[model samples]
Target: MRIKRPVKVFLLGMVAIVLLWVIHSYHFQNQQFQTDRASTYSELPVAATKVVKHAFGEVTIPVKPQRIIVLNDISLLDPVLSLGIKPIGTVSYLPQYDFLFRGVTNAEAAGIEIVGIGNQPILEKVLLLKPDVILMREYQRSLYQQLSAIAPTVVIDLPSLNYSFKENLRFIAQVLGETEKAEQVIAQYYERVKQLQQLMGERLKKIEVSVINVFTDGIIATYSDNETYNQVLQDIGIPLIPALAKQKETSLFLNIEVLNKYDADILFVMSESKNAALSFSQNPLLSTLKAAKNHRVYTVQQDRWWTYGFLGVNKLLDDLFKYLT
Candidate 1:
């Protein structure tokens, strides 16, 4: 029953080594946790000021803003929502254009107050809200001084060149310290595009797509290079009709006679109202177009198709998936 001294000594040594290894591992992990916590806090100091270059020179903003007021530019709604931050006040769009606020199902539940309309924001209402930061577009420059007096105003200038929905989201994210979330959102969006492409197969490359808005007055067709919806379609690998190849400075209002030139394998018609759809359908040339004849013409909501933002793009994608697939 006697154990060998040498074997017992070796066993004791092994036990000591294992205990030391466990303690070292625990201390290393604890130190690593503290280091990570310190790094995160350092990156986001309370009351930290970050200088952001916007449309109107440079402005310093808090690293973490509590109350944000989004004015005029409803496009920022999507990015703000994605970042999981609620703005204290926002400008209201027209009722017909409610799709601009699509995906925000519980605005009332979340306490998002509409302070005013895009063109005419009620400054008195905004002043009551007392937002910490104000986000707006350059077009609202007239109200800059007043808004700045109320809070730190950051004006986002729509970039003329290489501007995409993702770029816009990144700008908003940078202001809110949600750059990581912005990247994730962009990646998820492209992944959805990839899924749609897979479902579409070769048709994604060969199909000619056209996006046009039907109004009582006339039709406005958009080109791929400039328009946000068309740009997304181009990214999904759909080819644009030759007529839409050259970018116009703005959306072109075409008469019915020239509408046939822009006909495509698939047509997305953004109708202003039910009457507009009816009128567009009644056009004599409607039956002759390939998309119309084949029943591939989709009557989409004008707001959902025209609005420039992450949510709008995703809604457009949803419609494409519903119809094309």
Candidate 2:
């Protein structure tokens, strides 16, 4: 063929453009496919019916449970709400500490009914709410038969393991078919923990933090390694005083005379009532402590620290950011 050089050049340019267009189209489609796949996985449909294994045994629960009831353990409320599930009724650790519910705005606004307190739930009140599912601690197993009769009950071994807040959150998530939400909440929590570590810099490792709760009767309570607040402190690399770390129980209570035994760079004193605070301040040993002498003693709310759960831990972290920084 007797083709001109200019014509051949024009044809080659057209071919190159066509090839470039095809490559671009393929890449765009591939990226779109990946985006769609991720979206699908993230919003995967929950099952209609799921059989969950718990302390009591295997129980089938509705995938999207409504009218949920949380009893015995108030800590369960945080995880339930974190999963975007609002319980119809929940127990309080104690009537006096119902203020703890303030941590969850949704719960407060939802006016979530209070059915009972601690392990002493009012069966009549629970049944009246007509809950689809009930979550309770394993210690409440005695009421399982009765609770299950009203709704599918899932018993979690919270007390036995002294499970961390994340562990408990995941357990509740599994029961409610919200494992994805649980993971997301946990990821966000640890991310915040990392940010805290960065903010504190060298101080994170250098500080010795003591957490204590003062009572009206001259008793002092310190957290164990298993407590949720302590777990958060551990995550941020904050060391506890040696005296507290040696305790074998979930909490160690001491008389006011031995307060000096626990020394730390900073002290967090939690008191539930005015009398407790007054008692703590009145103690002569209060002035002798290293943290007090250094003017590093800070008062914290008992409900936020003494309670184990997600919302409380987050609040505690916020306080740490304020105090440590």
Per residue, candidate 2 scores C-alpha lDDT tens digits across 114-164 of 787655789999999998899887777778899999999988888644577
In angstroms, how far off is 75's CA in candidate 1? 2.1
Which segments of candidate 2 are over 4 A away from where they belong?
1-47, 97-109, 159-162
How well is each residue in 85-105 modelled by candidate 1, as lDDT tens digits?
A: 778888766666544354344
Q: What lDDT does the true structure give each of the candidates?
A: 0.78, 0.80
Worst 10 residues of 1 by lDDT: 100-109
Error of 2 at 120 (Å): 2.1
Q: Which regions of candidate 1 are displaced past 4 Å?
A: 1-46, 95-110, 221-224
lDDT of 1: 0.78
